[model samples]
Target: MAGAALPTAELTTSGRPILLPNEIECSLLSNVELEPEGSPPLSSSIHLRSSFLILTTHRLIFVSDSSAAAANTASYVPLASVTHIFLLKKSIKSMFGSPRLKVQLSVGSDGRVGGMGTRSIVATLVMRGKDDVEAFVDKFRQNWGARVWEREKESESASSGSSLVVESSASSSGFDSRGMRVVGVAGILRREQEMWESTDKSLQDAFQDLNALMSKAKEMVMLAEKMRLKLLSGPSQAGSSNDEELGSKEEMQDWLLSVGIVSPVTKESAGALYHQQLSRQLADFVKIPLERSGGMINLIDMYCLFNRARGTELISPEDLLRACSLWEKFDVPVMLRKFDSGVMIIQNKSHSDEEVFARIKLLITRPDALQMGVSAGDAAMTLGIAPAMAKEHLLTAESRGLLCRDISPDGFRFYINLFPEIRTDDIYLVKDQGIYATWIKCASSPSRLQ
Candidate 1:
């Protein structure tokens, strides 16, 4: 079957194809089928059925659109392998059937299609959804003709040659052409120099007006990514670097990481699939931050971080909310949760309330906690989470009867619930072995009440 022959594409946890460097998705079409033509009555299993076809600058990716996620798979046909794109034929049979187009592919002697091959085969893309087939075909042809991947390779070769020249001469002179000391890797420094020299005129033009800046946004993002990578590798390359140099590199890394989204999925690019694509992208983006934040983060905080990374293609609150809400439909590792206090957060699916509650239980049982109830800020520090998030957890624990809240001039605080241990019939009665007895000893101490 063609399924065994085609190259498989790896998918993110959210079912989005893992994009290659410089690869950008240009269009999305759902309910499409890819069938290899000119076969000896090919079996049904050979065709990719009812899939979401994504057109990128480098490939045509087909991901199964089945309701059963475990049954889904993905594959791709690289544009480099495609030799010709056939236009739709004007025939009576075509007028009534699903709109389709054909692509000629180069197949190797090893019975697989690829860039350099000895044989040829035809693959038909059958459009079963209500998408503009003509428009998709036009985009397909444009991307194929552009050969962006090939051009990127050529640029890299040229940049590599320039990098070698700079490395040989950089030791002789510690400064760049503009008299700035070399900071990071010598290879990257040389590329930066060449890039700036080439774009100096464009940079001057871009700053004169808003329209110019808008036009040059892509270039600026590219430069930011280069700097970010340089900073990332700086610490590893720093053998005997001073603390000041290290500090500056760290500061720059943080700024660049927060400000650069090399390729953000935009409404202009994904069209009808904007929120779906955004949801997948966000699912992938939040994994690292979620890990650093102990498997959860405030929704508002996420909105800021996501927008900051997106740079010029900032999404609105409504857009972010819509994108997050779509996560329920997709099989993603992260989920959106709302507490009784109306605070929303994005948390990993594996995050457990019981684990958080256990930590809070341990924290509140201490002698100081027994003398004076713990505030949200105190819990925040102990739990290593945001104060607002800690408060939400505290309130949730309170509702569960794990703890009790007290409001006074001192502040709002939470103490371990002693109500369950207290004797209701007699105010003076206390269990000698329980938390109530412990609280009694602590509350009666001289320094605690004063």
Candidate 2:
């Protein structure tokens, strides 16, 4: 049987290597390679051409651009497999030659490096670029020594234990405290007991001190997570939840879910490649939120979301703008788009105006919408997007002649583009079959026409 092919590493749409959870990029260098230099040649040829080497907390990613295509493929070497990293030797002969960094790794019996069952393999990285080899080596060593993967493993285990605790607690009695007698006045006694616990001298004093602030902060984060969980389960419970209660619950959940970013990439951590790293992290971070926002999110809203996620380490608007601007240089699924009106938004690169236009066309052709032009808010509800974003889409459709705008004291609204289809020469003329005719029939009804 043919040997198992290496597990193909996953990549982001923009060609950036997808990092493991808690994995942080330490350094990035262009024009680097990995090859077995002195090993006896095997039956199969191993090629190591020009590749981008990314050093991260968990692995070293080799991003190789395929000569046949515009896109690149990535391969990774786990840091755990590294037996020893060979320090670069400085010699007069090396002064005029390309710099090289070598690493000794354990390759398993199956020829894969790292993991419990793997043997060992020796690999060398040739730096062909004019970049500082010494700096790259320093970063590589730093990342290896950090042992971030181990820390992440520990954290995962700890969190799993905490989840189990939460599950058990949730299944048990309503309250954690257990010290009350059963009697006729037991219910009243329990209430008084709870009040007395609240009034405990130590507890009362704690609230008056700095500990209260700390406790509140922790409670706030937990509350947010709880609310998010409720929102996630809300639709399933909708049958039992009244509409008004559900609406309020949904609003509260949205607010809570928007409370934070558990972890965020920062300039201090990513260094010179901060923007590039931020761009990639932003791409990953926005997928869910963007989908919920109807594939387009205001730059201001994103800034707030991003900063909130970062928690105490908030980034300035300028930094956020710079990071967004860098998205063009990297292969990211989401891009920073500026409307003609100068309003900026972060939109999925795959998001098409044609799709929105098609939806809008369908919406306006509806009997109700035809009679009453769709306001920004009306479009917002129909499109499931923010009103501001919906207005932008409407304006964009109008610009493309897919729709027409009507400004009235009531508000700015859009109607189906009947301009081209309508016979301007004869105001009353209606084509037998067309959007205009359909719209006319709908509009002609007094009850339908507002």
Give TM-scores for every candidate, taking all chains together and pairing residue i with residue i.
0.85, 0.65
In order, the Cα lDDT scores of the candidates are 0.84, 0.72
> How much does candidate 2 score in TM-score?
0.65
Candidate 2 positional error at 209, Å: 20
How does model 1 score by TM-score? 0.85
Q: What lDDT tens digits, residue by residue, belong to model 1 across residues 287-404? A: 9889998998999999998998887789999998999998888778899998887889999999999999999999999989988889999999999999999999999999999999
lDDT tens per residue, model 2, 59-94: 887777542212767777788877789889688877
What's every prediction's RMSD, in angstroms? Answer: 4.8, 7.6
Candidate 2 has its poorest 10 consecutive residues by lDDT at 1-10
* Best lDDT among the predictions, by candidate number: 1
